[model samples]
Target: MTVIDNTHQRLLPAPAADVGRLLDRIGRPGDPLWPSPTWQPMRLDRPLSVGATGGHGPVRYHVSDYRPGRLVEFTFDPRIGLTGTHTFEVIDHGDDACVLRHRLVATPSAHMRPLWPALIGPCHDTVLEHLLDNAEHAVTGTVTDPVRYPWQARLDVRLFSVQVNATSVPQNALLLEAALPPAAGPRSDLADAYAARVPPGVTTDPQAWADAIFGNPPPAVTALFRLRNALVTPFGIERGDRSAFDTISRTDRELLLGTDAGHLDFRASILVEPDDDGVTVTLSTHAVAHHRTGRLYLALVRLFHPPVVRAMLRRAAAAAVRPRPVTPPGLPTTTPLR
Candidate 1:
């Protein structure tokens, strides 16, 4: 029966009343305090009333208490093995400064104890500190001392972050369907799409994402491409070069790139479209096999394609918004920035 009582507080430069005004808008769109999209934004069904129900990420909770501007407390859903409440409090400090504090008081279910200190704890700390950073940024227009995520926490973030999922190639992904129009009906050799969440300020334009994704690719992805390119030399083929992929088409919300070789023809689309909360960035691919070897190669590569594409998109999104790239501890310096 282990208990947990964790607290994080930040001294804001504004008066309690002023900070409270910011607190009141916690779950609203463009929420200034929850450090959203990067982390799941706190959401409530309606405004901040006692009984409003919602939770950020996988954790579930509902408002148990609220004081217009002074405080807000949420009691966690017990089925998740956590019992108790977490809160955000605004403390008056006589003059032009106030303390903003977040405290979590809970007892984990027996099975949850083991995972808390390792996986959950680091992530919790990371989220709260960033929340506080957001608060400071809201009050002062900038965060002077932002939290620096440790490599392990970075891994945890990449592990638990919003998932990328297979989705319909959106209508806006104009190039996905346009690239191989001849193969559209039944002969389409390969077509796939995946979407990832993007936060408020990250680059939504495909060109910026292209730079981040292609310019500084994940280490494993870069290595995979290197091997892929090397396999083509003996065939006297022009190796696929990510940096050299031509911009085949463009729209306000989409960018298309592709290349051709003796055996393979390829095209990909990056679509940045707005969603209610932030943005949905989709990566859609289209390809045609020009030879039996090309068909075999694409079939083999399909087994590993989704995960690789997800990693690249997530890395690009992170580079667009994170203060600094966090590489896993043992990764080599020769690898891309993320």
Candidate 2:
């Protein structure tokens, strides 16, 4: 087995003690500044101490060493491919600043070699950068450059499949299935309302409402829709741009949004069909993986697709039932659908 090491660091404009205090709270689930959007927050079975078991999402690990306001190390489970330690340490940089570092030193087994550079490495870099940005925000009250996924990293992990029950407010299907011309697309009022409530730096363009049915959307209106879809399907894909929604397909009952991300092609639809009581809205996605890495990367995604899709669908259903104001006629809007 060959050893592979990855390290990422950020300088905070604060003292070591202040930085360490923030580091101590890094893995706590639901922390406002913890970067849960980039990397799912870690849920630990016990408090931050040696021997506590916890990991974020699918990765499981146990704490091997711990020190308050200084360092913590998690030794990942062997089943996760590489066997090694992931450590977070805080060091004094000067009277005014401190450096926070995350280091992963692991030896991968033969079978895991292809996965490193292709999938894991890119995702790791993305999540780490966001985490650092989160730390800076904690100390400085602002993030200089909010984290955005690199194009390659976004392409490598994009996968979308979700279904949501819009039975409570069946009219949601109408809103969900609304179409825009391939060029100047019409905005979805419901989506715009939702997007306005999202935090800064996220997009709320109405076109995103369709593209989000199957892609990983940023922390914008698409994300809100994805959460709604999660009520039925728990999974989604993320990318940085609206280029994914460039092409449009529409029928009386369905609306499709399509785009190509490098070597991968993505097509997603919102289908509205009548049911026993109200309408049933189904959001589905299909992808054409173009190369060897694409196939292999998607294979990994398939393992978690079912749960991810279901979660997204369930959430979307719940959201549809919430009351919202309808956009009035003749009101000025963003754009018009041809």
Candidate 3:
């Protein structure tokens, strides 16, 4: 019970329920293990296991209490020389806003505490910073750039382009083509919702299939989904989740939100499946509007249209699966979610 270390304050943009629901979705009972999350089964009423293997040796953890969304605590075996608790709490900020808090409580064995400064102190700040970013996205629908805790908040602005395509292997045939603007246009915010029935392996790659598509996408995608709704000014739209367009990069981009007086966010996700003959990949993309009036500005940008976006992505997918037969001037060929 000695407080060897603690991170007292972590704030998130979402309300309590949203954050809680998300935690349940990722670490709930029956959910498969995700690498090595700090929380363990002992913390929940459901069954759970704890252990990590990597550059470091194995570390085991014990869970103590589970209150789904409200709180989860963990105590390590004395052999591990560490005990800790993590709590997620929601508080009312105003009629329109809520605060989510994440806290860490830790005690290290005599041998580990003094070494904490050299061993774990540097990372504690980073872990808390990451938690704040994740929590904000979970509730607010935007992925804010990493910021320092309790001080010096900066703003982040960005633009994204996403494309999706479908093709059949062996036959090297193109199936369907689509994107946000509906046909060939770009900047179309329309959600490009499609269904495909294809053969397995014809679509998803081995390990990537389960990770990028089949599973629930990572938190960034969820944040994007939430932020997409709050854009009131420029009013924007999404074709698919941001995860579907992993090729897109955020570097060397114009800023979207500022620290002093701005919003923070970005997100993406995609899902793919194979059927009898081919695979179907669903892509969803979203953008955030900054100023209260920016929503209309963005929605008007819809001039780019969605159909055109889909066509381009489809062509790309076709090319990947099967080379398009080139008849001098004309030829065609063939893609997923987070």
Candidate 4:
């Protein structure tokens, strides 16, 4: 067994109590401050308390201790090669300042020790820095120098040929894959949520859904897309057509949307199917580059594609599960009798 220990700390211009509040809110799923694009918003099954279990994705732990406004500690449950304690501690630095420290002490089995230095360590360091930066921003109302994913951290992202093929193949390919909670109702609920946000005439058909959301994009996404195109325009890449979603494709369980920009042809599809656990939503894209410049543009798109799709799907899932308000009886309906 090899012991692996790491610590990271940040000084914030805020009271200890304030810093503690910010720390307590860490590890939420979909939190913007979490640096890692894949694992986000670590969620606990219950409120913070001793004996409660929580962690993100596959990393599960039991809360061993907690002191309000000061400390929280979690003990790992023998995962792979890791077993030990992780802690967050807050120290007071007078009334106007405080320091927050995160410590991890683990014993890694022989096979895992080598992985620690080469892969885990670098990624952990990047995440810690971002966490501290978020803490400072929450408490101080400013982030001096925001941490960005270094090349090493980006390289740490796990990539599998299977995942790529699963998402990028098939006509009107589904590029993003996700599973929603069984209680979220059904795929149609998610489709409705997405459909509600798209422009008029965009339907839930898989192909059209994909085109409206990806090819044409909404205003918010279009802005970002335009900016990216502007940066690469000098290199011969053309801007996307904002009117692409005006066309429609309808199918039983699949929808396809396609567009041509410069020397590349873009096709996207959405397929929703029910499964034993819940519904599976797939958003996929297939691009054909006719020349070198189009290939270059496609490469950049592929780099950012997964994270963007994940984010969009996550948001959709959240929206799908959100409880809707029920109007009480006797209230006037928004419709009049004919």
Best candidate, TM-score: 1
Q: Model 3, 23: alpha-carbon shift in Å?
A: 2.6
Per-model lDDT: 0.76, 0.56, 0.38, 0.56
TM accuracy, model 2: 0.50
Clashing pairs in 1: none
lDDT tens digits, residue span 1-338, model 3? 45765553434544666665655543343322111122111123334223221111224445555566555445555566666655445555555445555565667788877756664554444444545545554454443353332211110000001124432221111121221124322433322332223222233542343233323433454554455546533533333333433332221211011111133122222345444323555443334444544455445534533443344334333333321111222211100000
Q: Which of the two, 2 or 3, has more lDDT?
A: 2
TM-score of each candidate structure, all chains considered together: 0.84, 0.50, 0.35, 0.53
Q: Highest lDDT, which number?
A: 1
After superposing candidate 2, which stretches have Cα over 4 Å from the reference? 155-338
**Which digits, one per residue and each the tens of the lDDT, describe model 1 over residues 1-338?**
67999999888778999889888988777677776656656778998899999887689999999998899999999988799999999998669888899999999998789888877887888888888877776776665556778666677556555457789889877666677666454755678888877556456678776667667889999899899888867865567765356787888888888887777778888898875466778888877888787787788779888888888877877655454422233322221100
Ranking by TM-score: 1, 4, 2, 3
Q: How far is candidate 3 from the true structure (C-alpha RMSD, Å)?
A: 22.1
Minimal lDDT window, size 10, model 4: 193-202
Count of backbone collisions within predicted model 3: 64
Candidate 2 whole-model C-alpha lDDT, 0 to 1: 0.56
Model 1: CA > 4 A from native = 182-185, 198-201, 291-307, 317-338
Stronger candidate by lDDT (3 vs 4): 4
Q: Write the per-residue lDDT of candidate 2 for residues 1-338, one digit (tens) a residue.
A: 57888988877778899888776775564454344322335667767888999876567889999999899899989898879999999888889787888999998877778888878777777767767766776676565555557655554323211123222323444533343334212321111111101111122233333444334423454565455445423233343355665546565666666675544555555555542113345555555665655565467656655455555444443233321212223433222110
